[model samples]
Target chain A: MPTDVRLPENDLLALALDFLLSHGLNAPQGHSLARMLVDAQRDGSFSHGLQRLPGTLNTMKHPRFNRHADPAPESVSPAVVRVDAQFGFSCLAAERGIDALIGKAGTIGIGLLAVNNGFHSTALWPLVERIAAAGLVGLSMNPTHAWVAPAGGTKGLLGTNPLAFAWPRKGKPPYVFDFATSAASRADIAMHRNAGREIPDGWGLNGQGECTTDPAEVLAGAMLPFGGHKGSAIATMIELMAGPLIGDRMSRQSQDFDHGADAAPCHGELLLAFSPDIIGGAGVGEGAERLFAGFSDQGARLPGDRRYRMREVSARDGIAVSSALLQKIRSQTA
Target chain B: MPTDVRLPENDLLALALDFLLSHGLNAPQGHSLARMLVDAQRDGSFSHGLQRLPGTLNTMKHPRFNRHADPAPESVSPAVVRVDAQFGFSCLAAERGIDALIGKAGTIGIGLLAVNNGFHSTALWPLVERIAAAGLVGLSMNPTHAWVAPAGGTKGLLGTNPLAFAWPRKGKPPYVFDFATSAASRADIAMHRNAGREIPDGWGLNGQGECTTDPAEVLAGAMLPFGGHKGSAIATMIELMAGPLIGDRMSRQSQDFDHGADAAPCHGELLLAFSPDIIGGAGVGEGAERLFAGFSDQGARLPGDRRYRMREVSARDGIAVSSALLQKIRSQTA
Candidate 1:
């Protein structure tokens, strides 16, 4: 039997906001952080939604991770900005960076912003979707803690580094795509392990580089690239761009998350936004509308259409959360 | 048995160049085209190397695919340029585009160039590697004829749609990576079919969407994405950016190759080049050197190191072509 429980979107957001505020986050920080988390839930990315709130709050309460730092943006050019997150919540820093880039793109047709020295910014889709909602295309990539292996290597050398791209469509939802280059995410493996299910071969390898179907082996070894060498190559490219390009430490050299002062893991993000009007000239807007309409008419759905539809359904009805997870959230907040 | 062959690198280049010139290409075009093809052979991509020469020459002899047309730079901006290929050979157009963007990137730290109305550009890696060799990071993506299926659809809604990226390293060949986003390339399946071998299940599907190991089924149906939905998503994003964004006809909508001028099979190419100086300021060069040294010290070879080594070997010992293919090439020119 499936567990059934419901929560109003506003009530859930308020509760999360209150929890963050009580945990010592500033008013603005608390609100933005809560809103981002709720948005993920509303968008149906439950893995990154309310499930991550407790972990985030715990990390904040730890003396090693600072919660009050504010990001300051440094300008390299009118089209480029770099922000120092000052060990603050990544949600706020990323939002500020996105806003700056979107503003610049509106004028120059394109802009690039990099955020260094930040925490894990959840669900990259929302960030790109936000830019798309403002009538612009967005591309973003970030490196996380090491969780996956290079193509032929058995050791963990790369993160489940996620890359996201969002394109604005005419009347339908924006074409938003967010994915980890890894064959299977750590979260997926954990879920399968908990359900006492065997994993598929080629999803990962045991510690000795031999392919394995044991979830426990994957957890202890390394996650595999999605499509062998091709996915591995893409992840490597992301590491070079999001890691070294942004002047942040690579995933393999990331600081230990358990140590006190060094416990705050620094994540690097690279974002690019552009307006087609600047390039396509007079026919840009109408052409885009016509193009998207053609896609829609041909039974082709945009990237984020399914998620957007799911969100609409949940909003009209109510959000369903596992009773166990709901109780755990209440316990932690209390 | 493989044919034994011996010739100096210069001798082979001269022979290839002469062959192209005799077929119809001008001096500059023929030279660049020959070098690109030989480079592919030297780098071990035999499929795109001299093996494809017979087909290329035959295609050029026909009026539909022009070899003498000039690839003129249409417009240039600080950060972007547009090129009209004049329906020229795609290899030469790509070479010109990469050269222009690399030069522009030296000033702006990043530059984008889009080429429209071009033919099948051979392997994308060489173009990106050329830009990377100029101390700039580069990426290129192009959409081709309909050959692969969308995520849920069984029909060919997308091209194999290859994307390539290269990063400049201080003391090593750029880390060049390139791949088609399909589960298995049509070429690979064709080879299997020619050898009377069964393809791996899930590599392709028949028109009814049923999995088939028969290579003939694939020829009549569509190739699947590399890693199912994940690869499909990446292919879709590539199509959106490289196809619609460039105002080019897409996939099935593109004109048939058999229809000649009436078949304006427009393919779109997107190039992005970035200079490390923009990110690291005065320390850019030194930083890249140190990073490359560290990776080397840790037993990590650069991405294209093997290919570069292979090229050196091939140069010292000439590349061998099949007698059958060589005979075909001679017949075409005769």
Candidate 2:
């Protein structure tokens, strides 16, 4: 049995690119997906990193997967950029429209980008971070497959809908936070199940709607939204904004579209961008710095601080990957 | 001593208007404030209704308040509406800019209203509902005084930030949710303390940063965020967006500006409006109705369902008010 092995970031990117390209993805599509995965691994987000590739490969082989579809961006209005992902992965679609989104925001002080008919499985922070890097405030959210229950309902009617926010700062990374509205992410429960570990309380309910600690039971039934009704309301808001409000599939509808094939959810996403320089005047960056100081002074961890630390470590040393997973990737291309 | 009294909605509005005008607010200012309070009462959001008037009166009396100041709205860019509240209440300022906001969103698919140099203590739902009533989606958030602590740290550094969202619906009231990021609203804790009841766990921490059920201790110390870290992150985002990002005061700075006078916190509020027809296509409302049906079918309560139910009852039976509170209102103008 091969153990965990370390690989350079470039090497990891190369491996991911090879796997995606061999699976029939165009160069642009393959690069976008590979870049996001490599970045996730560099930041120690293991669940969103290489571990997701196996599932991606499977989804790619599905009949619904559009191997060569080209995402097209349309300027729907002065401040709105709508991108149709052409039923392909959302990565290249987002990449295609981000510049237009940023340009509109820069000129008008506010902008919105709506991505419809897309598949989103990666973390949202990457996109928000891109907006922040351009010295703008970013807010993004999207719906996934319906796996979580509405608060008070036993049946699954909501996705593990995720919301992400980023604020630009001076001389450092943007203040970024991306989180699932569910008590825990689906990936978290999957990890627990794979490890044969019981989940903690409040994570999910069994098929009968009773609380369950068994990962398998929760997986078969429904995951709970965090903080009871409050979290549920947020999740509902996300579903509306990222789904119906964007003219795309809601979580339940997305799952139904899969027809039990278990592919990545195809839906839509909404991103709002605001220019601090235009909206707040100058010195906005300084004010944001003060807020960051408040967090550090209170000994409170900033949302993405740990990830940044891991990023530095990954830069100094290579990312660690399971040896078997690497061999599996190679075998796919063979 | 009189018992609980019942008053028609018009009478309540007149009472609020009388009190505000007597306290030196201009006609438009007084009307805006009165309309919001009475509407809150009509919806059974008692905490944000007449209960908030005394604080507004006090803030109006404070040296920082511009009693006769006129709120001004200026178009900062193609899609941005900036309103200066002129150190007065935010209600009149929001009223001054709302039409422009709706117009911009209608024209550009998205619009942003940034209200700066304003004092806000009322519920945020009324504003978002107004946007939704105009057939647009609305999102609004603002930071209050520093009354809550971050997730892990003990000291009070974050505000009890409030976020509100609304979606337009056809042939019915809009779907809406407005909530504080705190585990419990400050008013809720105050009610418990006044009733001599212990608070539930996770609501707050005592002065030493230890969890406590004593509402008094919590009031003296710090309120906890709902959903722990996730809620804290949202709160922090609110603080930045409504504060520094818009050239307004952060919670701590707002508190400092009060100089122990305990007036309403002077800060800014941000509202983003989106036109569903321009972005989401014509069938968006139908899709949203389907999602609402999903909730009702599963016996899940939509966020604003109870409040809407109460609204109908208030319209039918009039509003019931504590006689003592009514007497106090009369005494204010005596």
Cα-lDDT of candidate 1: 0.73
User: CA lDDT, every prediction?
Assistant: 0.73, 0.89
Number of the predicted model whose TM-score against the real structure is largest: 2
Best by DockQ: 2
Task: Flag regions of model 1 displaced more than 4 Å.
Answer: A1-3, A61-64, A255-265, A280-302, A323-326, B1-3, B61-64, B255-266, B280-303
Residue ranges of candidate 2 with Cα displaced over 4 Å: A1-3, B1-3
Model 1 C-alpha lDDT per residue in residues B1-334, reported as the tens digit of each score? 2335545567657767777877777776778778887788777777777666666654564455666777866444566677766666666676777767777667656677777667664788988888888988899887776778777666777778888998876776777888899988878999999999999987898977678999999888878888878788788777766766665545554435534443323576878887777864555455345434544543545567678887878767776555565555556553
Q: Candidate 2 clashing pairs?
A: none
Q: B1-334, model 2: which lDDT tens digit per residue?
A: 2226668989999999999888888898888998998888888788888877777876886788988869888999879999999988998898899999999999989889999988885889999999999999999999898889899888788899999999999989999999999999998998899999999999999999899999999999999999989999999999999988788888998888888777888889999899999889879999999889988887998889988998898889897676787778888853
Top lDDT: which candidate number? 2
Clashes of 2: 0
- What's the DockQ for every one of the candidates? 0.35, 0.83
